[model samples]
Structure formats: structure tokens, C-alpha cells
Target: MNKLINRLVLGSALCGFYAGLSNAAVLEVQGEIRPDPSNPGGAQIINNTPVTGYCTEFPGMCGMLNLRSNTFNISFHSSGSIPVGHVIPFGFPATWRTFTVSHSSIPGETAEIQIRIAGVGTRYRLSQKAQEIVGLPIGMDEFYYHTTLWGASWVEATPPCRPATEWGRGADANGTDFTVFWLTPEDVTTCPKSPRYVIPGMSLQRLDVHYELRAVRPEKLIGGNYQGSYTYSMGSDFDMGSLNASDPSMTFNLNLTVKQDVKVEMSADRVYLAPKSGWMEWITHGRKPEKLLGDLRFFILSSSPFKMDLNCERPGIDTCLISNGSHQVPVDIGVSLPSPWVDDTGQPIARRPLKLGGAGLQNIKPAGLPNHLPSLLHFAVPQDSVKDMQSGSSYRGTVYITFDSDI
Candidate 1:
């Protein structure tokens, strides 16, 4: 009985060995490229290894024969509605924007990714009904790769050419191409360990590209909606031996539209008065000479040149006319303009006073106002002037503020 059991065990072991040999040369590679969830304008690559392979069935028995290397390539193509950015007039600042493309390959293989910009050179154009109206220059000079954010850094796939006319691609003045290389691991033990590699059991990689647009003289751009397009292609080059190679190359279109924008708003339509009696008391007692009546909050968001003006119908009659039947007394009015509001690192605007009776109209010409400007309104009556007024009299007038833009 012992001899018979040993024979059966031997037979089973031989059958397993033969099966491993038959499948030793078979390797299945799978993976996909997707957008990285944690980062905007970034991509992730995931590589999936086959479950039934010589390396899994007969690890030590197959030796190096079970070790095979495959190359996977992913190409990036810009699809419809890529991204759009606007250039404000007068060197107004704009934010940086990014677009992403991703690719995945078989696990445990070397990978290559190529980025190519194809179409009417690197110059972006303003189009009308598919007709080019104006052209703006664009190239690798205006583009940057986010290496630190992507975890794995990428080296220039090819040397830059002297007097490079276009971006990544070689001598071609109209087209550009660049490549990045990385390796996919066989398993978690061989995967790249980094904070960006959030998935522990999966082998993934990512890349990000950033871009921006600026207008030195926004006056040149039409003050309406304009459309443009960019053509790009991503091609992957790899070898899969007897298996079909993953075709990771594609062509895409990026549409961009620019719109002229300008806006101005006030915090309140009418400045409400604090109690009239309190104001009269303060003015009569001279308690606070520079007492604040209220603040006129002005908000301006413009991409064009503009000017603001303050006018009063009664500039010559610079008094809040209070009347009880036929009695009236004049109240003094004063306004102070703070420094011109600045957006980010813009130049500072000088402060000026708006004396209703002294000036014809207060003109505020800001080189560029991208933020809020608060003007303080103060009212008072000379101690002597209040003494001549009747006990119960009321006065009222109007102040007009106007904002004009040169688009």
C-alpha cells in the first residue's frame, strides 16, 4: 500500500511539471492610463500582470526563462475642449492652467511616452468660422512639466536643438515632440515606493503639464469672444513579441476661447445715515473733527482700461440742505480717497481728496484696478455754523459716482 501511494504522488508531481513547461513562454500584460484622482491636470498609469505564468507556476524551476521584459508606450493626444485661458489687458495677471494625459502598460515592463504638438506651428490663433484671424506664438518655451508633483521625475528624451523653432519635436518648425521613460514593476515588492504612489498593491505612474497665456497689449485682442485650437498626438512605441502590442497612440484636439471681461460693483446702493441727532451733536461739540459718516465700498474687476469719477449735483452748494418749512442751513461735506486699490503686485495709486466745492469733478484714473477701493465719506458742521441754524431743520442732497471703461 505504501508503494502504491508513492507512485500516485509521483504521477501528480510530473503532471504539474509538464503543465508549467507548456505555459512557460506565455505572458499576459495589461494596464490602463487614467487621470490621477488626487492631482488636477495629472494622469496615472496602472500595469496589471497576468495571474497564470511561468513565474507563478514554477518560480525556481524556470530560472531566468520565466523573466521576460516587455516595452509599453503611451501617447498623449489632445481631445476636444482642452482648456482655455484669458489674458487681461494692461498686463493684468492671469492664473496658470494645466491639461493632462495618461497611459498604462503591462506590468514588469519598460515604458515610453511621447508628447507631440501637431498643427499650424506652435502659434495659437484667434479663429472666426474656422478662419485664422490672428496668431500668437507658443512653444516649449511657454510650457513646463510638474516633476515634484508627479513623484517620478522625467528627463528630456532628446537633446534640444539650437534655435529650436517649435517645441518638443526636432528641427520641424511647425511640430514638436518629447518623450519620458519609466519602468513598471512585476509586483508590489518591485513597485516604485513614493507618496504619490497612493495605491499600494498596484503599479502606477503619472505626468503633468502646465501652461499659461499672457497678453502684453490686450488692446490688440477683440473685445468679444474668440476661439482657437491646438492639435496634439501621443504615440507609444513598444514590443510585445508574439502577442499584439498595446496601441496607445491617439490624436486629439484642444479648443480654447477667450472673452473680454470687465465689471464694477458697489457694496451698497445708498449710504444710510447714522442718527441725525448724533451727527449734529458730534459736529456741534467738535468731539471728533474727522468723524467718519460712512464708507462707500467700491469693487472693480476689469480686464481693460477704465476711470472712475465722483460728482455731486450740488458741488457749489456743498451742504446737505435741511429745511423745516422755509428754514434751511448748510452742512459741510468732505470725502477722502484712499490709495488706489491694487490686485497682486501691481503699482500703487496715489491718494487724493475730493472737495465738492473746490473741484469740478474728481477724476480717478487707475492704471489697473483689480481689487476693491474704499472711499471714506465724512460730514460735519462748523461749530459756529450750527449755532445759526434753527433747532429743527433737515437737509438732503445727492452724490453721483460713475465708472467708465475703455475696452
Candidate 2:
């Protein structure tokens, strides 16, 4: 905390009400005239009665001067749903005549000033009034308050029958002297879930004061109090900017290898609609999925490019078989599909035709004779190249699946 000085009050004719023999005198102390509640969002402030007890001047050259009148000004919250007000306890000496004096010494200094009310209690009393005025809202923890001063004055001089530098060589004897004081409270930690005090009209909150005393003579001593300000915002959302979104870049690619004689295992990547027993159909109608992966496509290499055939039959002597049609479906380069009619090499009959006991006796084979495989193929399509092929290649193509929809 740094002390800022801009002495501007005009010098008035000194009154000898309780005056000593000094031509000039300087008296100073730090204090704040904080409002009741000291927070805006907690509750409205209706009334506040502050009692300030002055301390005795240090036992230095300026200690001999008698006291005079003092002024007190209270400022209220300025924004939010609650508007602030101002009250001046002017001519306070005439109103509250009990401004007394106590004493305490600076650790290493010979001088000592009287003790006033403790910082916490002074603000606590004001808070009580604020809460009483403002109805306590849910989640609110404190009310708002602020204060200022008027008619502040001081001088520099020697006491009656005493030398100008009576205290010591450092005594004023006409050297520059100045003092400023604030009536504030100690720093108190706020509750975590407590509603913040927003400045009345502004978006700022939690204003703090950092103060220090700068000594041009003797030693540099600095001290001050930090309390909530009613005129400033009391929340953390004061000054902010913008936000951002997450855009992910994903690349999908398919590796197709025409192995000489590869043994590949096939399994369902997704239980899409499950396998149906008889004629069945399905239709999907909804928003396009972000990502979809189909089943694996397995097949063996043929001397010439050709389409694989599909067929199926019930195990045992039931003779139940799929359509007797031999259909051909195109297989892009390097794609593979398993065949059941032939041996492991796709060239030898593993089982004869099943006996249906009817005119369809052309296929009469035992249940699991040698190998009558299932009519399912798994393959991985080159997804990453879809965009590239669509952009760099020209096409005059129409593709179709071997199984057509009955609908």
C-alpha cells in the first residue's frame, strides 16, 4: 500500500477553543467511514450508527495540542437492485461528545497513540444495520457500505512555554508535515458459496484498499486495512472476454491386401439389426451419424476379377435352403469373401447338394459334412480416400448390393 498525497484544504484561522501556545500543529491517523453490511447483494441497508473513538496523539512535539471538532461522512452502495445513500454526521463533536483516548506504542518507537475501537467491531456494527434494512436474499452473505470524510485539518507548532523543537531534533521546528487516515476494517475471508456483492451500477465487485505510510523523516513506516467497498463490484466476473469450441480432425483409411492364401477371422463389429431367420427388411431414418464402421469384408484372390456368389441352407436333413439363384456382386481390388462350396483353397467341393426329399434333391449333403459356410462377409472400406476420390476422380458408376429390399 502506497500513500498518495495531494494536500488541498485551505488553512483556516486557528481557533483557541482549547488551543496551546503553538503557531502550527500536525495530527494524523488512518481510518475509514465504511457503510453498514459492507456488501451489496446480501440485503438492503436502512440505517447505520457508527461510533468512532479517537486515540491519543503520540508523545512527540505535536502531542501537547488540544483536540477540536471532527467530521464523519457515510457513503452507500451505488449499483445493483439496491441504490446507495449518503449521511454526514457533521459537527460530530457536538453530537457524540464521548470521543475518548487510549494508548499503544509502535514496537521500536518511543511514541504511542491511544487505541480506538477494534477494526472488526466497527464494520460489524455497520453490517448489522445494513442487514436489517435489506431483506436477506437466498445465498447472500453480506450487505454493502462505504464512507468519506469532511472538514479535515491539522497544523504544525510548539506547545505553550516550550521550544519549537521541544520533542527532539527531528521535531517540526517548521519542517514539512502531513498525515492521512482511513477508518477501515481488517481483511476477512468470505464464504465460498456466498453470493458476491456486485457494484450497484457497474459489473465490478470485491474492491480492496492497499495503503502505506511514507515517512520523509526518521524511518519509512507503512500500514493499512483492507475492507469491502460498497461503490465497487464484489464478484469475480468483472472483466472477461470470449470462449472457443473444439473441432477435431479425424482421418480414416483402409488397408487392402490381396494375400495369396490368408486365414482371416470374421466377427460382428456392430450388432446392427441382428440376423433375421426368414425374409426381413430394415430402414434407417435419422440424422447422419458422426462416424460409422461397417463389418469386415473377407475374400480370396481370383485369377481374373469376378463377383462372389451367395447361398445358404439349414443344417441337418431339413433341406431348408436359400434361393437357388447364383448372383454376382462386384469385389473392388483386393477384397475377399469366404466360399463354402469349395475346399479351404476355394476350388474343391467340400459337400454335395443337400437332399430335400422333394424335387430339390440336387443338393443333399450331411449337416456339417465338410464345410458349408455362412453367407456373411467382413471387409474394411477405404474411408480416408472417399473425399480424395470424390474430388480428383471422374465417375460414371452405379453400385448395387446382391440382396435387394423387398419393399
Candidate 3:
């Protein structure tokens, strides 16, 4: 009877020891949602406590959360604009221009959260004074703004937030004036039915907002200064238990300015004439004469009509005369205008070349000359005209080239 009692007591003790071992928690699962530092406008899930040791039971739950909670915050890090110096032509479509907006979020709990965007002032306009000067039509809008969810492939939002749809101007704005996008977990089965989910502790996810602007009536857009502003609110529908935090929102001011201007530049400050040996000599019977002066290259950029003039510094100095203090040799002057320059788009424009003549004010109106016109000037002395002149004399003269805008 004593032996039987001892065996029964030992069995009971062993059972209790096994139960205690099974109930002890080994690996604690703790994480949160937060913005990823490496990736702009993105978030990632971070483990609060270094995950170590092994789970003997329910191993999957060792690094997973079991409840939904609002433990995340959203903030913007980077913003970008359209290409600098990009000219928006009249009648340009909304599809031609785009601006990228980026933001990130931090989630505290391991549940799905919903993200929605709201904005104020969608249709921006130039200053009232500018509108009057440009004679903008009544109720004429200058720019139309739109937003879309930026995904691996841009996903078009439905109805009120449709792609390319105008976001009207206003102060009182709501979801009806914004767009909605989802930040889903890699394993859909882990957080099914949740709009956006994060691991426990601190998890971060990066996102992007695509904003596009289109010129409503570019024809009425006068060249001057113009500007506008707008406010955007990024709201998250997550249960923030007791933490007192402000909702994430941002305001962006949209502005643009157009100026009518022109730039003209000459390749060289002073032109040098070729040596006497390089000049066309009557002795070279059949060889063509080389030009006495090198071609002058002119680079012009203009948005309006312009004129170029070549004038001799001294009166009656058009012809080059070499004198040995007794006799003189007269070298007749010749000017050749450059051919019309062709643009990159294969457009042909005519650059009005001035006719050669004795020195005076050689006025040239380059009618039909396209912007960024590359022009050249040629100078020469007719061999026949100078054949009767004596040689062995020094000559010097000055010609001034001037460019004027006729806007």
C-alpha cells in the first residue's frame, strides 16, 4: 500500500511540471508601423524587441500581432515639380504634365487602416490684375488640377477622383474632392479584409501622390507673373486608442510665371582678317579666291520681330584701301548672308540676308526667322574689283553689328 501511494504522488508531480513548461511564453511578438528612412515616401514594419529564441508551440504567433489598433502616423518627406524651363504650349492636354507627391506612414498596431486624401482649391488662377490685362473671359479658369493613386501601375480612381478629372477650386473639401489608395500587406491572408496593415511595434510604408496640372485656356495666359495656392489633408481611419496626436495634413501653393524675353550673342568679340598670302591673288589664274575675313557666327533667341544692322565706323570706309603714302589700291567689299537655319523639329525658316553694297547702315530684317536662329556672315573682296589696285600696303577698318528687338 505504501509503494502504490509513492508512485501515484510521483505521477501527479510530473504532470504539473509538463503543464507549467507548456504555458511559459518564450518569444514576445512586438512591432509597429513607421516611415522607412531609406526609401522616400515609403513605410516598413519594424520589430520593437529583437526576435530571439525558438517557439515550441503556436510558432507562427511568435512574430505576429493578434489585434487591430491605430498606432501609426503619416507625414510627407519629399515633393517634386515638373521639369524646369518646361514651356506649356497653348491647347496642351492634361496628359502632358505631371507632378509627383510622396509621403510615408508609421503603424503601431497590426491591423489594416484606410487612407484618404482631401484638398482645398483645385482650380488656381492668376492675379486679378493679370486677368484683366490678359482679357481673360468671364469665369475663365487658368489651370485644372487632378490626382490619382500611384501604384506599380497607376490605378485610376473611380468617379469624383477619376484620372484627369479636374479638382475644382474651393475651401470646403472632402473625400469627394480627393482620392483613396490601399497599402496592403505582402501576405494578404494575414490581414484579410483590412485596408492597410502593419506588423506589431513600428512598421513603415511609403506611398506616392500623383498630381497633374493642365492649362484650361492657355491662349488667355498672358506673359507676366502668376500664382495660386492649395491645401491637402491626409487622413487615416485607424483606431488610436489613447495617444493624443494631430492628424497629418499639408498645404501646397501652386504658381507659375511667364516672361517674354530674347537673347542674342555673337561668337567672337573681334574678327581678324586672313594674311595677305591667304587672300585671292590674280596670279592664281584658275583657283577661286579665299575670303579675306572669317564668317561671323550669330546665335539668336527671340519671341518677337528683330533686326540686325552692320555699319562702318567711319563714313565712306566701306572699301578697304591700302596706301603707301603716295598711291592707293582699292579692294571692293562683298557681304554674303547666311542661309535660313533649320530647327530641330524640321521647320524651315528664312533669315533675311542683307544685300552687299558700299558701307552704310546695312539694315537686315530677318522676317520668318525662327527662335534660336543660327546665322553666319561672310566677307570677301572681288578679285576683279581689286585687280587694278597696287599691293604692299597696310589697311585697317571697323564694322559694328547691332541687334534690336521689335517687340
lDDT of 3 by residue, 330-396 (tens): 3333333333432223333343333224122222323233334455554444455344434555444
Rank order (by lDDT, best first)? 3, 1, 2
lDDT of 1 by residue, 76-172 (tens): 1222221222111111011222232221121221212322211000111111211111122333321232122123222221112111122232222
After superposing candidate 2, which stretches have Cα over 4 Å from the reference? 1-293, 296-340, 343-373, 378-380, 387-407
Worst 10 residues of 2 by lDDT: 14-23
Compared with the true structure, what per-residue lDDT tens digits does model 2 show for residues 1-407?
A: 11111111100010001100000111123342111112211211111222222211222322343211121221123223322322111100001111211112213322111222111100111222223333444333321111110111111111111122222222121211212222222222211111133212212111111112211111111122211111111122111111110111111111111111112222322212111221122124322212111232322211111122222122123222111123111112112223322322234332222222322212211112213233232211123322222222222211112110000
What's each prediction's TM-score? 0.29, 0.12, 0.27
lDDT agreement with native, every candidate: 0.28, 0.19, 0.28
lDDT for 170 (candidate 1): 20
lDDT of 3 at 78: 15
